[model samples]
Target: MSARTLLVDVHTHLYLPRYASLLRSRASVPMIRSRADGDRLIILDNEPSGGRPVGSQYWDRDQKLAFMDKHGIDISIVSTANPWLDFLSVSEATSMANSLNQDLEEYCSSGPSFSPTLQRLYGMGLLPLVPSISVPTILDEVDHVAQLPHLRGVIMGTRGIGKGLDDDALEPVWSKISDKGLVIFLHPHYGVSSSDVWGEKDNGHVLPLALGFPFETTVATTRMILAGVFDRHPSLKILLAHSGGALPILSSRLASCITHDPVVASRLQHDARWYLGKLYYDAVAYGAEELGFVSSTIGRAGKYGTPTTEAVAGSSHMTFGTDHPFFPPILDAVKQDSKWMSVVENLKAIDGVRDWSEAEKSAVRGQNALKLFGLN
Candidate 1:
């Protein structure tokens, strides 16, 4: 094993006071409101509970530090949680995004008043992503955010420029983002189409959280590949959440599908497998077996001197993460525990993979993220 540290949580979130206040003021899907009980703060959603409780951890910097310390997270690249700027009007989205980005920059650089430990925090900036916004406006925000000292990248949902990531209208946005060397942290906001995955009933957010989120990432990225985005911008760095949401398992299948399609083949300069190699993945798979499979399959090497059949056949493309704040413990579980079950599970999975040296482990935990996002 190489001499390196064991853990870094690249995929965490902090609502940040400014963004939290914005959510509280609104009355829509992304808003926050106190329940009739008056004591409980809940995020507004399209479900029966409205949303989960909004606590200090979601908005307070002190709580964030404490959570990180308890969980053994040496570093965290925080970002706004889901439903980011998607519901706002064009003008409102742009302004709020700028304000939120500025606030995040400040909080990450200087510790929040309540907690000195927050000085260790790093973050990815938010962007205005409403459908009514113009492409140039979106590009401007991306360029501006890319320049912030503490801003390592931009957190974007699967919905690209309105018509999903495959839409040609978004090419310039992708081009500008790629050219700026800003890592695009692709997350999932919209779940699978209801008709295809669920009935008209509530399942306590399980379907969306477990299945819908990862599934959304898979489809959006596949569309981006099919559209030749990677072929056009080979340097574009994308970090897919949830270990690429079955992409490792399904990549070969996707490649086969693309290869068999005459129309897709004729338009692209390279194959789908080639594009996958250019992408990066977060180590968020739930099990060691899954993590090892994803790591080996996505970028494994071939016999002799030939390029591996898998697109991304190297360890550098994988990084560590913990989807925090969103997957808090259930009501009956221990609330004050230092480590979250969700976080520990991911760490254990990565550690349990056989034949990985300490250096490779350290790289996956934080070094890979540091290199990819330009974090020191």
Candidate 2:
């Protein structure tokens, strides 16, 4: 394992008080229901009774800082949690998005310092993305996020505007974001929505969350790639969640499918596999082998447009993340010093990769994030 220089988590989340209150007031699947133990968050339709426990960790800034300190994470780039404005009407979502962006600016800019030049926190803002929202309105929100000093990016779900990310409506928004140089933290929420595939089991959320989320991300990203979103706005900076789901492992398969299709192969400027190198991924895959494999896929992507078939180490495109508060210690930590299993697993994965040197491990741990976000 390499000695730690700095640790940055790009995949952390927070539901600010304003947003939490909105969820608390809702009567739908995305709402929060109060329980005897605490507030329970029911974001997913199939998330089972009692949902998941919601407490200070989801909202309180102090708790966020405590988690960072406990995990030795020096800097965190937080985004709004899932089901973000997805369930609201256009007017309501527009108002809430504005207030939330301002709140995020305040939350991040007012946080304590990790160093003289850097604050411990930065954030990704939101957009009013309901189906009824016009492209002009979406562009307005993008402009709003770009002007916020503390927000370095915008976090979004697979459903872009009304349709999926490949929809033509999102092209202007993509171009504006690309021109502004803001990173897009693309996350998953609707997760394939096919209950029959999992059968009628009482097996908790394991199937939907573990398998469904990643697959949804893969499908969404593939659609965007096929639509040539990357080729249109080549400068768009995007960070994919959950190691780009299964996209890394399936890139070659997708390339083969694309090539075998006479119509599809004629559209793209570069091979489909080349796009893997253009995106960033989170180190939340939970195992050393998966992380290492994802790194190889990303590293090897550079060879697609070049003559050389040699691979390169791609730790620079992967950033460490805990997905904290979502996956707490399964067994309650007896001592305050005990780390969450999720965080530990990700860190160990970075260390346990067979051929990664100290420098590569350190980059995945934090340095890559610093450069990607232009953080000091």
Candidate 3:
């Protein structure tokens, strides 16, 4: 259709066989439980029927390619979805992480032969961030992933090698990530666990997914900013999910807070606003207004400084994504035939941005990610 545009979806997901096996072996919330209908994934502790519908889409390569073809997607930079390796013992996590990485690498590289113009696949591998594991071992996995031929980077949760991402212990990991030129698909897994806040009513998973997930990413990133991770590892490229989880909206507020606080004002290299350039946002917000607001905010980041083009450094930071397989079409036709509504919504968001030039839209559609992930 529009092959010249090189449409790429950077937010798709798949759990490798080994990882699925590990989840199945477990009796926990993040496991795949047997059901009369079929297996279902339960990521949250309390979710019973609220867990994701598990199907071949979770593991089949042909299904992934078919989804891409149906959506007119040229490439998919897939990542393992949430609740990654954080729940295992140090030794168990280490082994599982390596196995999962290898499995993912094999999957991404060894796909069934297809035309290069359609459905070329690349991936971000998982890291073993189980608590108390040595930093060098973590670095080892970082290096290991960087070396994988088809692995573009590592997808990580907010929690670092046990400590949070803000922990000084992660400095080495950051340094290595920067040095390796690996993109960090900085995703959120742990949402706020406040059951009381959900109120006396059962609103189901809506409250946690809608509010808690984004807020978790916002807090984790702000914590990293306060800790001066961006200042130290300025070259570190992090692609934030859910359109950076409200960071675009809160960046100015964060900067305002940083300016007023005596302790916070003296901390680092640049304002909280400036850090937006140092970050990348996935266009998974699913609205023209949301995507435009995200792009405008990232581009607006540097205005707080003295004066320079650096202010608009984040304008091209947006890369298109479809949180696929998770948000499948509910309608019969969309479900049976061509495009998925979820993917169509994201594409419409990109296509509908009134202020964006064709070049800018094209960049967000695929070029930005191709350059960022070294796919070119």
Candidate 4:
């Protein structure tokens, strides 16, 4: 009989007790506290009235295994949840980042108490980027994680150093990470600037979740493209969270804008569409049509101006993810029995794609991530 297919979850998260305790001790946006009415897990701006309830799933290995089993995930490359060291002082951020990375490495190596079949768990390390930490310190941490056997790569927020990912000072950090053969899992922590999107009122985190998160990722990556980061580091692989935000849909338009503007056009060797091919997208789009568009658009190769159908079929760039712990079931729903709506929607999108082979589906489910991060 054929070997059981490998299903990998490259984007899952684990708070891990050591790190969760650190968040609990603090009283800030990234911190966790119990509410009077019920426990909640809050990790965002303006969470002044205290955040969500920190539970076992956030820190418990057993729960992670159970969740993986229910979802048929063969391996999970876990990482620290968002707002990673972004709010601390420069010195404190560096220290906390080092500690968190060590903690994650230790947990994965020690082997959590779960079925032996669930033993393929792994992780992506964290980095500090607050109050302008030095590049050397960042490089040191990257090298440290690279040496760890189970540590695959680093999970980072859009903001690099302080200015953003486009800042020239961050080039060395990116270079070192790429050289180490580590995939940069580019995730978004700070959503869109509050002033630009949502006003004072709380829409139950809808603003950040629905709009800010993906848009922030799109803008950060766009800035990198315009700055020629991809051209400079052609082999540097980045796995974009949330299907590259709006990049896939807006790439052609972004290219058109660059062409029209002589000032921006003069700074780049190639157009915006050229860099789209260099990047990788996750299959987190909520609909099959959107997933199909992302796959067809980014997976296309050949000349720059070639039509999507005419372009050569390229390797699959999408992977599966469940933005868990954050999008848990509402109070009205049964938390344990009901699969997450967000995860279910993503699965359906992948299932609905036409013309994609079983091998391509397996790759999107896990193989591509395995090859990308060298997790095999």
By lDDT, is 1 or 2 better?
2
Summarize candidate 2's per-residue lDDT along 1-376 as a digit string, tens digits: 1225899999999999999999899898899999888889998776776699998899899999999988889999999999999789999999999999999999999999887778889999999988978899989989999999889999999998768999988999999999988999999998977768888878788888999899999999999999999989988899999999999999999999999999898888778999998899999998999998999888888788657644545888899998877888756457656779889889998899986898899888988988888784
C-alpha lDDT (0 to 100) for residue 65 of candidate 4: 78
Report the lDDT tens digits of candidate 3 across residue range 1-376. 3434888889999987788888899887789988988888998888846577897799888899988887778889999988998888888988888888888888877875335533388889888888889988998998899889888888889988666889998899899989999999888887888867777688877888888888889998989999999888889999998898978888888888999999989997777887887789888887999888888888777775556535564448999898887867666654566467678888899888877988888889888998899866
Alpha-carbon shift of residue 3 in model 4 (angstroms): 6.7
Q: What local distance difference test score does each model get?
A: 0.76, 0.89, 0.84, 0.78
Best by TM-score: 2
Q: How far is candidate 2 from the true structure (C-alpha RMSD, Å)?
A: 2.1
Runs in model 4 lying further than 4 Å from the true structure: 1-4, 47-50, 112-119, 199-202, 305-315, 331-336
Supply every candidate's count of residue pairs whose N, Cα or C atoms clash at under 3 angstroms: 6, 0, 0, 6
- Runs in model 3 with CA error above 4 Å? 1-4, 48-50, 112-119, 306-314, 332-335
lDDT head-to-head 1 vs 3, winner: 3
How many backbone clashes are present in model 1?
6
Q: Is candidate 1 or candidate 3 better by TM-score?
A: 3
User: Over the stretch 1-376, how does candidate 4's per-residue lDDT look in tens digits?
Assistant: 0122677777788887776777778776677776777655667766545566668888787787778777776778888888788778888888888888888888787765324433467889988777568888888889888988778889988878789999999899889988998888899987876565687676766777768889999999999989989878877989999888888889889989998988798777666776777777777777888888877777643356334424534337788887665567665545557777667887787778885777887777777777777854
Pairs clashing within candidate 1 = 1-358, 2-359, 277-311, 277-312, 299-312, 299-313
